[model samples]
Target: MFDNVKNNDTQVSELVASICRLASCMEGRGDAAQREETLHETLRLTYKLEEALNQRNERIAYLDRLAMTDSLTGLLNRRGFQAELQRVLASARRFKETGILAYIDLDDFKQINDTFGHACGDEVLCHIARVMERMTRGMDYVARLGGDEFAILLVRSQWQDGERCIEKIAHEINSTTLRWQEHLLSLKASFGIQTYDHNSSTTNLISAADDAMYLTKKLKRDKCTLSAAE
Candidate 1:
């Protein structure tokens, strides 16, 4: 009887040991599954972060383009053009070459705005911008300098080529017709051309070009008044 009771107690102890070993195996499997789930979540978050960074970079590029470009005409704005001009001038000095600057003012543009309407004036300006862009080379710089004024920077060009370019630009401006609200609007531009010297600073070159443009405007006005009197 004693031996039988001892044998029964031994069997019970073996059974309890087997149950504990099985429980420990299940707990280890559960821990491994939780670790795998955490790893997947971390990978998903990393992917989302990468996508956000790419989108932000694209937005920054778009804004930079907008800042450099004019909203209405799609040409370079004054600031952008000036920066380009400076760069060109620096290159020209390094190469010992000449560049040309043309100052263009739309003749009687304010009258068009006042008589026709602001909308018509805007159309005219856009038309002129397109014409200038079409006439100039890809390397050239064209910009609107506020209101009815525009400027062009021609690099590595001579005086005669500059004159020819301005003449062509003037012809295009004179021939362009803007039709708005059944009204045909004609336009003209007075230009001042100056050749840049290596010795002259950018500001001085711009001033010289501005003076020449004013002189041209004055001459054109005088001629028109004289013709009217005749």
Candidate 2:
């Protein structure tokens, strides 16, 4: 009976050892699986963060462009135009090249607005802006200086080139047709051209261009008044 009891105790100890070993194996596998799942989750989160950052950067770039552009005519706004003019002037001073500036004013724009409403007037301005763009080169800077007033900067050009640009723009504006509802509207622009002098400041150059534009307007007015009298 004693020997039988000792044999039973030995068998029980071996069974307990086997069960402990199995439990250890299962715990090790579970730990490895948990580690792999954690790594995958971390990688997924990292990818999402990078994607969000890229989208934010793209939106910022788009907003910057919109800020520099005019909403009405898709032309450069006054601020952007002024910056370009300053840059060109600085370059001309350094390189000793001739630059030309032209100030453009739409004739009878207010009358158009009064007759056909602001919406039609806006369409006319957009049409003129598109025409001006076609007439000028890629290197030239053209901008709408608020309300039917526009300007062009021609870099490294002679008087002949300036005259050619003016003729092209004027002709195109006069020829372009704006269809507003049932009516077709025609428009004209008066241009003032000034050649930059290396000795002059940017302000002086701009002033000269403005003065020239007024002179052109004055001449047109005089001619119209005389024709009316006749």
Candidate 3:
């Protein structure tokens, strides 16, 4: 909204400047040669203003992209993802559609950081991000929700299909290995999925997904413990 106001101010200023220049040219009507020169100067200034406005628009667009994107993985950041989700919700309200939101957390990301510095950890995250992009459909949205957290939105998908898609994504990510220097790094993540419709809010859905992910992680831990006992 502030950007809109700023842009409007710039446009108004340009229009006023152009009007003033034309008025100055009309005021010197007695001097034909001077008026022609002023007319040409005004036309030149108008062209310059147009170019400046175009450049300003391009700059704004670039900044907007930078603001929404995660620098490390080149995926949408949390803010960007929220904006996209809200847009999806608006569409859901209008069309009575449904979608899936999955929250993912790396199981042992801190261990990797503790063992092999932050730089290696960063690279591993990037690799995982790439794997996620490869596994999902073009219509789905992928985002890095800070730290070791990521999210995917299955837009307008059937409930059963969305569940299956998320399950495949989790498996693909778990099985993938990254060769970093002398060590081969494998990452595993816990995922929680929740379906959203016109009635869903962003905060509630994310919170629910997070709870589900934690429960999934607990089940995995319990299974590991039982297997070890055997």
Candidate 4:
């Protein structure tokens, strides 16, 4: 990897040197015909060099984005999400500000995969990601923590604001109807919100939120069961 980067850098330097040499040749007091020919060749070389540079830069950018993004949902994967969370946590600690971390798990996602197919399940995950992206603020970070789990890092938000945001996210996810082929699939998500405190560790914060989410899921299921029994 290091060798590849070094080689690319060397190639760029060589191209730049070639351009400079061509410019100097153009400035020489030589035969008019020779100078004219050099000018045409220089122009062609310059265009090709510029094109090469653009392609190289674009490829580097695409690779960087892929490194940080989840292939399935186009959201930050676990590694990327953890990095961003650490940055946010550090900032919150330094500034003595508060933030919210929401852990979201899709309800009955496995059932979707079992009944429909993995492709359909994949579409549902993408739909949920889109809904979270649409509902959250620009500064808020949304990430896929693999499978049907996701995390939202809400910066500079109060506890009440966090609650409201989670509620809105849950509502939007539950309300969405994704039509795949002939089947219309509806989804619901359970989320746990935890505020970042001065003493909060990343591991504890995430675990706490996850536990809260599971509790909520259990309560919801128990309520349904009780209602059915009644």
Q: Per-residue alpha-carbon lDDT of model 1 for 1-230, expressed as tens digits?
A: 34544554555455455545555555566577765765565455456545545555566667677787888898888888888888888887787878789999999999999998888899998999989999998888999978988999887888899789988998888887778898888888888988985665789888999999999999988998999999
Show the lowest summed lDDT stretch of 10 residues, model 1. 1-10
Candidate with more favorable, higher TM-score: 2 or 3: 3
Which model is ahead, 2 or 4, in terms of lDDT? 4
What's the number of clashes in each of the models? 0, 0, 0, 0
Candidate 3 residue pairs in clash (backbone atoms < 3 Å): none
TM-score of 3: 0.88
* Candidate 4: residue 191 lDDT (0-100): 86
Best by lDDT: 3
lDDT (tens digit, per residue) of candidate 2 on 1-230: 34544554555455455545555555566577765765565455456545545555566666776788899999999888888888888888788878789999999999999999998889888888888888888999889989999998887889898888787887788676778999987787788989985665778888888899989999999999999999
For residue 29, what is the lDDT in candidate 4?
47
Candidate 2: stretches off by over 4 Å:
1-54, 175-177
Give lDDT tens digits, candidate 3, residues 63-145.
79889999999999999999999999899989999999999999899999999989999998898789879878898899999
lDDT against the true structure, each candidate: 0.81, 0.80, 0.88, 0.87
Q: Please state the error at residue 73 of candidate 4 in Å.
A: 1.6
Question: Compared with the true structure, what per-residue lDDT tens digits does model 4 show for residues 88-163?
Answer: 8888788887888999999999999999999999989988888889989999899999989999988889999888
C-alpha RMSD between model 4 and the true structure: 4.7
User: How high a TM-score does candidate 1 get?
Assistant: 0.76
Task: State which candidate, 2 or 3, has the greater lDDT.
Answer: 3
